[model samples]
Target: MVDRPNKPSAIAPAASAPQPTVDIADDNSSITATLPSGENVTVLLHGATVTSWKSGPGAEKKENLWVSEKAVLDGSKPVRGGIPLVFPIFGAPPANHATSKLPQHGFARNLRWEYLGKSTSESTTSGDAGTGPTDNSVKLDFGLYSANLTDEQQDQWPYDFGLVYSVTLSRDTLQTMLNVRNEGQLGFDFQMLLHTYFRIGDIGSTAITGLSGVTYTDKVLNATEHAQAENAVRIAGETDRVYKRIPQSTTSIVEGDKPRFDVVRDNLPDTVVWNPFKEKAAAMADFAPDGDYVHMVCVEAGYVSDWVRLEPGDTWEGGQRLRSLL
Candidate 1:
């Protein structure tokens, strides 16, 4: 964990204007970044999980990320909601694989990450001749390396690798990017995913667009392959499907006729849509207020359809940007 200064340094305000700021918790367990526009984001060092994202400004601010009310925050377990980083492997690993002995979703989301500080950039939101109110954005970087893993975790998947996960907060968008670098002589195969749990008004009234015509594996139906026939996918029950090779990079979550969120992906070709519904939601110890399932949906972006092989000194990068339209 990073040590917080007695008097935390903040971005110096420019000419009495409210500038973007980044605050590390007194205990250095989490960090929060606030934009001048009133939008804010918070991330926990545990798993480098993004726990909150409030969009819009002032009285219109709204939470866009859904975190379970009972999610364990003491570093005892991987967070149940919000955005959890998945790496090395996704889901249960197959027999004899390099990650077979590892737990589901690998160790990235179960370990603490080091804080790497932050950077801020400003852009003109309006007006010409560089005379407009500046829209400020802040990017906070967190890192995890093979050395940071536990002895057991290192033995389970022995490989030298470094991961840098960056979360950027802007006026209306939240972006997350992950960069993976193989730091050893041996090549390794791995999978990665950004499991994002989005808050919604109502699951029944919400529809996901931009996956039509793509083939998907229905995890709920014995991992059977199926084609997506619906232009707008809606949830009615326990749904778990992995859409492979998405034709478009952008997908939207729409409530009624208005889009609530837009997810833009970069270098991530696969997307997973999941909703636990009633029974499974109640079965999970971390998911509180079981019925709250109707208010959240997971639209995850990743390269889980296949493994990515990284050779010595090679690097891989991928990310997603989420924009709140509500």
Candidate 2:
């Protein structure tokens, strides 16, 4: 009692004063934020590379590299996929509609993405550390605002438009929303793709559901082909097709053995799936040799094979959702 006499009675104030918080890191080359649910996400501003995502216990350590770092798409071989945002065309020049001088896939994909901001909600489903449901997670928004090109870019494609690409990563899903604002006086025509690459257990074991009646430009077959399966179409070898005239709000299911991922496009009209199976993998240097084929697959949503014309003051929005199921 004597020792405790000097201590004031333990009583809490009406409300603990708001804790002093540090500002978010906004420097170029890196963007980081702590969500309301305590989850954290970071992106490398330089390459718009997703650096880290973490939640729960084992999070004393965070997971990094949402996209491949080693894979560089210069002229040799591209990353194959992973929401690359290809525009105008897909493959290299001399082979496809693309031209070598146009900066393959247009300049949007390669441009540096700016950090718009971060958002969180308790609405997302939560999971444990090592083995928990990362499904229904927080949505982090990162985007690039349209800017007048430097002397360099103007020499390539001369057009003025406010192009904004917003990429949101949730627990079970990853969504990319593109808003192309026509700010110029002239109406321009263009095509785009949300080249998404999903990690797969085995390329041969999986299939993509949806796109039953849709017609596709078979880049490999050199003709248009219809979907054979309504549920999921399995990937075999060296597949390259541009499914066109697809309606918005379609589901593309990627099924594996235990964990399956379904890519649902909210308003995407096209889907392109590619897997350089044998000879192509060997011919390309960016690809991880033949042995690494089992790791990923590209199912892209695009306007390619179909041209979209945007008039001045008009805006076009397109988005894709990546949902993973166990």
> What TM-score does model 1 achieve against the real structure?
0.94
* Model number with the top TM-score: 1
lDDT of 1 by residue, 1-326 (tens): 87766966787765665778898999988999988778999999999999999987566689999999999987999999999999989999989999999999999999999999999988877898367878889999999999998899989999999999999999889999999999998999999999999999899999999999999999999999999998999999999999999989999999999988999999999999999999999999989889999999999999999999999999999999999996
Q: What is the RMSD of candidate 1?
A: 8.6
True lDDT of residue 318, candidate 2: 80
Tens-digit lDDT track of model 2 for 1-326: 35764777878656422221113454455555554334455544433544444444443533311245456634233344344666544554333422345666666556666656655433313555534333333444555543634566655555677766665655445566778878878776777777666666667777776677777777788665656545456677788887777664665545554446566665567788777777777776666645566666777777676667888889888877665563
Off by over 4 Å in 1: 1-16
Each prediction's TM-score versus the true structure: 0.94, 0.73
lDDT winner among the candidates? 1
TM-score, cand. 2: 0.73
State the weakest 10-residue window (summed lDDT) of model 1. 8-17
